[model samples]
Target: MKFAAVLNRDGGTLRNADLAALCDRMCQTLETAGHSLSIDVVAGKDLVDALDGATSRRSVDIVLAGGGDGTISAAAARLMGTKKALAILPAGTMNLFARGLGIPQSLEAALKSFTDGEIIAVDMATANGRPFVHQFSIGMHAKMVQLRQKMEFGSRLGKIRASVKAAWATINNPPAMNVTLSIGKAEIAARITGIGITNNLFGEGHLPYADNPAGGVLGVYVTVAQQRTELLKFFFNMARGKWRDNQHVEIHQADRTVLKIHSGSSKFRAVMDGELVRLDRETTVEIQPGALNVLVPASIAKAEAA
Candidate 1:
């Protein structure tokens, strides 16, 4: 297969990486495996353009995007419903989407995985017609991301620390809004602190990312905690992957959902795959089963199939 690799120069761990050496290694690795590869290292501001250019090429079969979750999400959005597949290089803080895809977390290991990777179709979700590989969240998660982005963080560890601090701040002063959730014929109205709609149901373990990206449903979680203590407990349970046991959270699954936010503010913000964006008063969220083609470690793919 022919691959076009786009490395985000300003994303997470890649900010301090040797791009030239990495590109050389990628080319050599892929070529040795009977595949051809071309690489582009671009600034964050130019990432979208680079991705667009790479996807537009007729010679490219797979686009190997190297960066954090946001970069991978952007690449996935560009490749939706297309014949090209996406290969992820996890060079970020959490690398949640990479985790869901079962890609190696380390750069070197991820590169080697591509030598024997298999292409598989996975589910992708969308918010207001915009594609996302991960979750679309509002309230607490969005507020935390907004707060963390304001603080200076150089390295991956620094970013994690900043995120922890932001999470604590959000927990202390959580935002609440009137939300109407519509799933199928059922409609539920509630005052919630936060809400998240994931691409698939999050598996129980260490992180909140989905273990089965091929699950053709959206997982909706709404937090109704009002007091600081309740909010703190909810977050604690979520961190321990015991959110299902938390009474403050309501979990539901659906093929599609409509969210209407009744916040008084004219402008609202939400987090879509870790990037903050303006939110519409009413947003339609839905899962597209097997809409995205991704490259995963061959062994993992075989094991899952078995």
Candidate 2:
């Protein structure tokens, strides 16, 4: 396979080695197995254009984009409906999308796996017209991203530190949005603090997110907790797969959903694969089932190892 990669130089844990040196090592490792690989390093802001340029090279069969969920989402924007496949190198804070795809956390392991990967059609969700591979969410999750942007931390533990601080800062003065979620004939009217519509059902465990990205259904997760204590409890239980048993949070599976601000029409911030999006009074979410062709472990069993 002929492959090209764009690395997010400022992505999580990217300072471990010099950028060019690392790309050379990756090329050597893949080339040793008789596969061709080329990599380019880009700042997070430039990744979109870089992926566009790399994908334009018609000879490249796969494009590897390394970063967090935000970077992967950006790549998916260009790769969707294209003939080429996307290969992820997990180099982000949560690496949620990569983990959901069962890609290993180690960059080297991910590269090796891709060299032997199979092309699988995965689900991609769109809110309005924007594409997200993992999920699109509003309320608390979106606020956390906004807070993290303004805060700084040590490069070594920056991701962890920023997360803790962001959470602490957002828990109080929680987002107050009264929305009506319409799924088929069912309509839910609630004042929610968080709403997450996933591309597929997430696996249960500490992280509690989808491990299989190709599942053709959308999982809708909502938080109805109004009190600070209730909000904390809701997330805690969710991390343990105990949210289904919690009254404050509701999890459902659907093919499509429509969400609108029931009380007042206002523009708000939404989190799409870890990126913030400003949405109008109403946003529609639908699954573009099998909208993306991407690299995944050829062996079914190994692909769910996240």
Candidate 3:
């Protein structure tokens, strides 16, 4: 097997000499599994272009992405609809998407997935034609990301601190977006403070994790809290996985949905699979059934089968 491994050298946990060492270790691991590899150390924002170039070579069968969900989603945007399969190396703070796939966050355990793994075609949600692996959201969640990205926090804990600050900022100016949402033929008009559309259902209230990756449905979570205090309370409950019980929140599922913002502005800011995006006009959030081929560890496969 031939692989093109792209590491987010600057933004992830591993940095400088440490990142280089991890890359070397990753290459060694792949080679030991009787596979050849070419590694690229790129900045987080440049990952999509780098991976796009790597895949254009058509010399590699799989692209191994190492970083947070943002970096992974960037690669997914480029790799979507392609014949190549994605192999994730969970080099992030939370590794929610990796965890959802049953990929262990530890480097050694994640590396072992490629050694003896099976490619599973999974659903990938799209927000206005942009492919996302995890989710795309608008309002408060997007506001948090918008603020979190601006903060210069070098460490993971610093990121948490930054998120807290972002939450406060969001509370100061609560988001109230009036929109008409269409799920199938059902039209609903509401003022939504935040809405999350994940590639799969989140079950009851699993926080940021996907309940079923191959369920072929999009989980739609909408928050109706309109006040500053209500926004904070809603987010607090969400963090504790109690948001579903809150009367201000609504959770549902669909294979496709359309969201149209009411009058006000032409374009709105959104969070796309952990990345910030500015969306103009009505956006179609839909599931592309079995659109992405992802490789998972043999252990995960066996466990799922069991």
Candidate 4:
């Protein structure tokens, strides 16, 4: 297999030495497995366009995205519906999408595993026609991602500082918005702080991507709390997987959903797979099942078989 590894050099914990060695090892492993590999680095601007041009020329069998979820999602946008299989390296703060595919955290292990993995179909949800792998959120979580982006954390201690700062900001100012949620034939009204719609349940205590990504439906979680104490309670409820049981929060599973911001407030923010975007008075989200083909461990197939 001829593969093009699209790498983000500045994304995660990788240093010069680790990255050099990873590339060396991956090249050797794929070569031994009777495959040819080409590595491409995506710089700051026009990242997707550059990779798309490279892959198109080489007719790459697999386009391996070696970066954060944002990079992977961007690359997946171009690779979807093509015969080429998408690969993820997960070199990010939270490798939720990569973990969902059962990829390993260790760089060498993930490369080796991908060389022997199989292609599988996964669902991709869309918000305003934008693709998202994990989940989309409205209020507090979107604010957190924005805050976390500004902190510029490279070390564990720096990450701690950023987290603390974001927590404080979230506590100090909770968002209040009137959201009109429409799913199937029902329409519900609520004053919400945030809304999270996931492709699958990651179970309690696990990251949202702990479940398989190609599950064929969307899991909608809406958070409705306007006070600090209520936010803490919401946290505990989500931790215990009792958010569904909470009166303030509403949970639903559906093939598609549309959320409209009916709040009289001026500005609002929403996150689609860790990337934040400003929303107008109205926004629509829908789940597009089996839109992307990805490479995953054979174990996933076995589990589905069982």
Which lDDT tens digits does candidate 2 get at residues 1-306? 998888888776674547777787788878987889878888877877898999899999988888767778888888988889998888777787787777788878887787678888788988887888888888888888888988877464776788777876777767878999998899999889889898898777658667667778889998878787887777677768675667987888888899997655455688888877776688888888888988886674354344
Give one digit per residue, the lDDT tens place, for model 4 in 1-306: 778887877555542336777788878988898888888665636567766875585568888888766788888878766777788887776778887878888777887787778888887887777777887887888877778878877764576579668866886797778888888899988888888988665555555563667677788888777777878777666656565556777778788778888886456678777788777576677777778888877777567557
If ranked by TM-score, best first, what sequence of candidates would result?
1, 2, 3, 4
Q: CA shift at 127, candidate 1, in angstroms?
A: 0.8
lDDT of 3 by residue, 82-201 (tens): 889888888777777777888878888888778888777777888877788888888888878887888898877788899899989988886778888899888889988888888897
Better of 3 and 4 by lDDT: 3
Minimal lDDT window, size 10, model 2 = 297-306
Judging by lDDT, tell me the better candidate of 2 and 4.
2
lDDT of 3 at 186: 89
lDDT of 1: 0.92
Best by TM-score: 1
Local distance difference test, candidate 4? 0.75
- The number of the candidate with the highest lDDT is 1
Alpha-carbon runs more than 4 Å astray in model 4: 15-17, 236-247, 264-266
TM-score of each: 0.98, 0.93, 0.92, 0.91
**Two-way TM-score contest, 1 vs 2, winner:** 1
